[model samples]
Target: MTAARAAGAHADAVPDLVPDAAPSAAPDAVREPAPVTPEAVAAARHDLYTDGITACRGAFGAEWADRLREDIEAAFDEARRRPGGAVGRGPHRYYVEIHPEQMRGFAELADHPWVRGVCEAVLGPEYAIVELGFDIPFAGAVNQPWHRDFPSPELTRTERRLTSLAFNVTAVDTEEDMGPFEIAPGTQWEHGDGFEHGMFPPRGEFPRYESLAVRKYPCRGDISARSALTLHRGTTNHSATARPVLVLGVDAPGAGNDAHHDMAVTRAYRDALPERVRAHLHCPVVDELAPIVQKHTIEGLVMGDA
Candidate 1:
């Protein structure tokens, strides 16, 4: 009958939002378990990634793959001009490239309807984009130490906070053998200053949080994101191929979570996004009072990169 109906037939909503897959030897091998259909992948993704929900992959195709490729390319192009402190030789990663149109387009993916529902599920309709970015791990990239993006209040500090979220482009497609990122869900809610920067390890070396990292590493051809408070990290990219990903940040509209405390600096980078894309995500629409878009800096872990 209905897709949601069928998904619900075999699965009960799990607290994590990401319910378990069909009983199989490769449980976390990326699947579309019944009840947790691709339609529900976002729901399951959010749950497993954030509120502890999980679903299965019901839909997959070339169109989806191509779209992912395009976005990854756009993000990379944006990253080239983007700036931040350097970690050895890699990019500092401070600006989010996906503008409104891209954000809307990404949400429109037939296979990811659950993403919108999940975002609405947590923050409600008024929720504006908090933050979104793309990650391209080069062959020699360093391990993005275990950490959690804190939902720090904005400069205005008036209840304005954004949540951390993401989806996979599967540029490299991860399995136990290879990986782009590894997640430790709910550790964002685990309530501890855990890890080097408050992150939950996906596997070994975490003599502490490793015990809770029971979830299998997500295989490639998957999409994932987490609540504002979820603990995670972009572990070392062991694969020879560059692992590219499109990242998204979700923050309420008009809550003081703009580029940063320095409106001028915010304008510089926010203005840097593709004009068309910016118009799509208009959180008051990028205001270019200045003639030339230039660089400016923020105070501290302002979150959302730029």
Candidate 2:
């Protein structure tokens, strides 16, 4: 049975399967209707707070998208050549965490007005980048079970405010067969027993039906910002080409814990970044190589144990 059906069954089996908060309206029925504009950014801020996720289509121009796409291809080639690089998650899926400074044309993305605006809206003006990596799901990759990025029972139990936001930018147009990112809207605020444990719950334990999981299709240049606590998963990729999306994390000042990823850039590169972009980086610059790669697995990808 599908995860949603199984979750429903589990609810019936357990008398007090903590009922999920009533789901919000289906995302498709009332999808955000504006392009990435000043007004759209404002609306997106509201959506991020209320729905826990939002997208800005064509936030960057086509030229910028093309440049990013080329960078991704180059990064992939470079990773494949380095030791411990181009790690496999499953069949065709792979991932690598590299320094943004090493990728040409990527530095601009961190300072892109629209991208920075959305991130700042949710993570606050003092927000800083906590993690950076590439998520590439190729053909034959299977769907991941629904879960949050960093689940902290303690934070969920006491904190009602959003502390961190995830930023995703597609290197290429995300077609349906590419298995674009999917999310269960509005689950950011829900907390349950054992929710803060380091591990994800079984598939059957997810409230897939209640959250109304929806796949997001963002074309080249589109960017998405979401609360890290929001329930989400990477779906199956049936297309011939690999889908590579840039993953970035921004945290409110003093909002993260010890588990967050720490990355560094060259001193020269760090000095060149705009004050806005530099403020989000908590790590200091080093002269050595950046972009550390390690073996990848579903467990590592989900629980970050890797």
Candidate 3:
């Protein structure tokens, strides 16, 4: 089936979008039973709209979390062993995209109900996965400048609304010293060349916004959903180990035609996934997955040249 048709089939299976507010309940009331209930979906939608991001703790169980962590570590090792496997964009930042086929354990998360619910609420029911990769910042890696995932400074506020969402899953417990992900709350609404440049102004120029940046320390299994336009950065990793986070991009139908980060999985793998999951992955399926290698440097990382 065509990619668009696949996306439509996937959308048809999603539950109806929920309202922005849940039923009134006391602060001490009992919690909902389901992991992605209508109430939970509504609250997540509200946060994404108001704060530009939502952090869902324990979104996945310990079993899934443990498997993903192990797979990620194995992928890292494999990448390093392969010729030109590890691409260094900076002192300690390694760029790698673990093909979905190789990391099936983590790839299945794309079809998890809770994940689909959030994507449906934020990017509409017709959303599709445009890219998936691993972002590993090892010890001594420098902080990344604040930036947006896409460049579209000319789009109006309404034009940019919910066009794409980024779902990040941490592979390990993110501690303060680990240089967790940080973001400027509510900055997703800001538009213009300054915010669209894909890199923020120097700290001296925007001290207040820089100072207001909040650090997010999410434990393993936590999922963070945010607009692709949000102002955020990956902080420096000071610990002895590497910090690897899985990054998945879901875009509203027709929103990512010009995206540069498109990825492809093997045909066998694509055919193996359930129809529900296949719909989200609309990219081409190749006969064999190839290694992605790129030059790495601090300047390249800051400029996004890599």
Report the number of the highest-TM-score candidate. 3
Residue-wise C-alpha lDDT for candidate 2, range 1-306, written one tens digit per residue: 221232243321111111133212223324343554777678888898788888776566656666765666566656665566656554556677667775666667788777778776766787777777777776666776666766644655586778878788887666788778888788787674454353355556666633588788876667888887777778787766567788777777777532445467888888888887787677757997665655322344544211
Winner on lDDT between 1 and 2 is 2
The total of clashing pairs for model 3 equals 3
Angstrom error of the Cα, residue 234, model 1: value is 2.0
Q: What would you estimate as the lDDT of candidate 2?
A: 0.65
- How many clashes show up per model? 35, 5, 3
Tens-place lDDT per residue, model 3, 182-255, is 88888777763554344444444356667778889766667888876677777777776567788777787777
Computed on alpha carbons, the lDDT of every model, listed in order, comes to: 0.41, 0.65, 0.65
Model 3 worst lDDT run, 10 consecutive residues: 11-20
Order of models, best lDDT first? 2, 3, 1
Residue 274 of model 2, lDDT score:
81
- Between the candidate structures 1 and 3, which one is better when assessed by TM-score? 3
> What TM-score does prediction 3 earn?
0.78
